[model samples]
Target: MPKVKRALAVEDLTKIAMYSDPQIAPNEDTYAFVSATVNDDNEYQSQLFLQKINGGEPKQWTFTNAKNSHPRFSPDGKKLVFQSTRSGLSQLWIVPTNGGEAQQLTFFKNGAVNPEWSKDGKYLVFTASLKENDDVGNQHEQTKEERQKEKEQQAKEPIVIDRLKHKSDAHGFHDDKRAQLVLYDVEKATFTQLTVNDTDHGFEDISPDGNLILFSANLDDDADYALTNDLFMLNLATKDVTKLTDGNGSYGNARFSPSGDKIACFGHEYAYSGATLNELYVFDVATKERTCLSSKVDMQLGDVMVGDSRMGYSTEGPVWSLAEDKLFFIGSDHGTTGLYQADLKGNIEVLYKDNNHVFGFSYNGVDNTFILGISTPTNPCNFYQWKNTELTQLTNANAELLEEVSLSEPETITITAEDGSEIQGWLLHPYDFKEDKKYPFVLEIHGGPHAMYGQTFFHELQLLAAKGYVVLYTNPRGSHGYGQEFVNACRENYGNGDYTDLMSAVDYALENYDFIDNDRLGVTGGSYGGFMTNWIVGHTNRFKAAVTQRSICNWLSFYGVSDIGYFFTEWELGKNLLDDPAKLWDFSPLKYAENVETPLLIVHGEQDLRCPIEQGEQLFITLKHLKKEVAFVRFPGANHELSRSGNPEMRIARLNHICGWFEKYL
Candidate 1:
């Protein structure tokens, strides 16, 4: 007898635990990671867990039940320091490696995050929000009642906007402030302010000798109007700051090699504008000379592969070899992200290759073991240990929840685009698929027209398939994981080439698969994908329904309202509204609103700053005014990340809205 499994339900989203941020111990024997689950209060609760390489049950270290992250091992590996929000604000806390009561380290009013250990483990450097003026420290010197009154007064005060980039999508309406570095002496229990510049000073990594701290900040006089972040180091002993890279481009992820003679980083000149791939570089700290290592490798240095998860993931670390000759990093290639090795002589090779997507990773040279966070179409992102070319799973946080639900494994599909470009995609059959019966189809597009949809688990797709829809998603012209030239293809020629690629996928599916009903087709996407969804319906009425989330409608208004609008518009569209008004209007979906015949469900977060709520509002209002079939769904107190890592309730509601809209129209 065969056992039947239950199809995945939308409510199962909250039951699954998302794992990320795995930090290996200094000796590579033990590792600490974070796991997030929705608790009874409907708020996402993240806790730190410790695991050994040998194999055993993973132990929960932090019972705070709030957000706890960035688990780091001290030099001696005797203690672990992490950031926690147990005291109502995120602050640094330490716990003994063996086991003991968690000890509080900092009480800064604005809170602290991203704790970095010095080579000797004597000092800890971190970043905190600060007032732009810098006349007073960030600590809250006022009492509780006084603070309440201040908040009350501000609620009734008039709104003000002065800075060109005062608001960010991650951060809410904070005063025009920058994040600055602060030093904490673990033994002495004292705090020292490191930099007092008006610009943001973010900590990167400490030198091997522990005498200097490397950071990146835009110190240009007109920083607000320009995009520049140069690498700099502050001498702890002499309190001096020195610049390392020229202002030719933006540089970040600076790390000191084992020998401390050179710094390996990931960045590049905006040669191709925003569509440019991040290139790897080696800088001589002593000579101030730089060399781009991955110039020959056209792939992006880190993972930008897109997936649907409550906890986000990306390939971001750049670790050095024991001999400081070769560097290990992650690269997006052919719809999958994998480990790659680079040398000082401008050589690179793949150390690990697989069809799965690598989200987060860490390497420990002491034991020669690697910790990889990866995901597949059926498997969620989890930690795996690699030793001597052998692999083992470390944590299966979602295994229990997944045992009760059924999921479809996506089949990889490849097709040649109109321009001879290879387009990679995936197709998921209905859970109860029958070859004799026809099924409705939905095309899912990813955000970041630069992001790739690869071998990863997407809950929304699973639900759509369970409801008898054939789900098809692809890596179009502008998607990452393909080479640099392919990623930049959809930049200036938005609906021309990329639109053809998407339409070609639909045509390929209709020709190859006999189960699809061409008349009952749908489309949905967020961000750039959202923009494409609107464009798809306006250009052709092939889709019966469409959903655009956190979308952009008009480039003229987007150039001013979006946090990075003014520059992103020029970077993506290749022209600002001021330089080419007619072209901007020509590409805007708002200009073609009268051509839309498909029913649309506009979804957006009220607090989204990247594509402000007004973008969705304008589209919905225009369609309604024209007596078209349209509806709008807004999530309050949510941002652009509402679908990914936003509040659990809101995320579930959003998934429901997506499915309901498709059910009603398709």
Candidate 2:
């Protein structure tokens, strides 16, 4: 008899090295990428690796074991510049490819990040946060001890809030700090502030002529109220700026064309608010006329395949093709992320497509070669070079570890919702499958409400499947990848539309799959998914067990607590908490907590600013007060990203807590 391979365990996933940020060298043959893994400190350790396209073992470039990323190769290929926090703060560092120690390039009060090398390679444009009253020119002169004294004094003072957007999930409390566009001249070793908006200025592509820089900013007085940004071009020589966008829509991810005759950007008119499908647009440099190049393509023009990498979003340019006649970019279909190319005539074609997630990619238009970061259900993530049709694997970060572990593959399924709309989802069978035997089932949901779940390696789901439970997850309405109308259908009607879609998926699975035990069922999710789980338990008792993590219980409270609460409430709910308290109360899961019958588990991260621990606390307390079977588990110092990029031990413990609860109940 053949022996079965060991099923995937949480321990095995914690050991896999997650890869991101693929950078192609100017030489066109070599590229660099970042590989991160959980270290003994229970924190993610990052390092950059260099590899050749032809064929060679990946060579470790930086050994800082710190946060080293955003690698950019100089035009001469003699130097590699990247950002690292080895200096106690995030600072730009550069090193010679041949051999040399990295040298720190900036000493600002707030460190720099996301440095972009210019076409001439003489200047680097980066983003850095600055206090409202801080002086950029004199910040480097202030000593750390002096800064600490000032901070200590400021801590004693009360935080006087004035701005509408005074906090965010990424930038805690805002602190009146604004991220601005700054330019660094490598030759002069000087930093110059370009824009003075109190808000952040996103640094985009630098013009080919090296005379102007493109950026996006909402400089209006009521910028926080309106969720739209306009493109601006700063002339380096004259220190003048030009507004390119009309501010009618939220425009970003701006990239200049090769000839400088056009600009390609991404955005929508907020036609459907949060559910608006990302559209690709082109602006004529001379005519200043904007056109939606992706109007004909029914798909969303962004990479929405959810994964466990913290490399930032992969919504790259509508990058211009080498010939300047076409543009290349990434887009999502049913459940796959594909690299696509579009022409000036609004025609888009898939250059590469498969049942996998392309988290990022770097292409050398001149050489017609590409380095892509891809992952499948069984694969973590690795860099591959697309030379013609063959994609050569350059980095096997998880190959050996995965060889001994068994992973489940998802079977794609489609079900019709109550509204006659088609919903897409995937079903994963237990590792040791027996078609005639009954098995417990778990229904998993994804957050974002805008993020798409697809054929990717999700450690949590695989671990559940390994424990003899069939898993079902789907991309319901308000999720990207589907057409515009489908995603918009969930607006202002969250639980009703999306909830039914999820229920329909479960119904379809229970009726079609013979092995699934209908009586032994469970449900769980995080963020928006967590909110859904809370809503599901309150609305129905179909499942025997449920776990809601970092969920939303009360929209009225959420409107004031969550980092993006104020505006996110208005954008998603279509009304502010004060305008219609009853409306938000009607949609809140806490309002329906009295109807809950299934045993529930509330999990949350203490440091989660996005959803806040209060969300979980409120639900848990309310359920306990009502004498319901509920439990609350909290992770110290963990954030909303606990399941994905949190501490190694905490992630494992969270998974164990979930599996243990389901095991006990189901």
Top candidate (TM-score)? 1
Error of 1 at 302 (Å): 0.4
> Using lDDT as the measure, which candidate wins?
1
Q: What TM-score number comes out for model 2?
A: 0.96
Q: Global lDDT of each model?
A: 0.86, 0.85
What's the lDDT of the predicted structure labeled candidate 2? 0.85
Give per-model TM-scores: 0.97, 0.96
Off by over 4 Å in 2: 1-4, 132-155, 309-315
Q: How far is candidate 2 from the true structure (C-alpha RMSD, Å)?
A: 2.0
Instruction: Give residue 25's error in model 1 in angstroms.
Output: 1.4
lDDT of 1: 0.86
Question: In model 2, what lDDT does residue 532 have?
Answer: 96
Candidate 1 lDDT over residue span 1-666, tens digit each: 656778888888888777888788886778888888889999988889888878888899988668888898999999999988887778889989988998888777667889989999999999977775543233653455765888899899976977786778988665756788988888887778888888888788999899989999999888878787899989989998889977878898889998788998988888888888898988898898988898778798887878777373323667898888888888888788888888888899987778887778888887666898888878777889877777788877688767777788888898788888779899999987899999999999999888888877788888899888999999999998878889899888888899999999999999999999988999999999999999999999999999998999998899999988989988989889799999999889999999999999999999999999999999999999999999999999999999888888998899899999999988
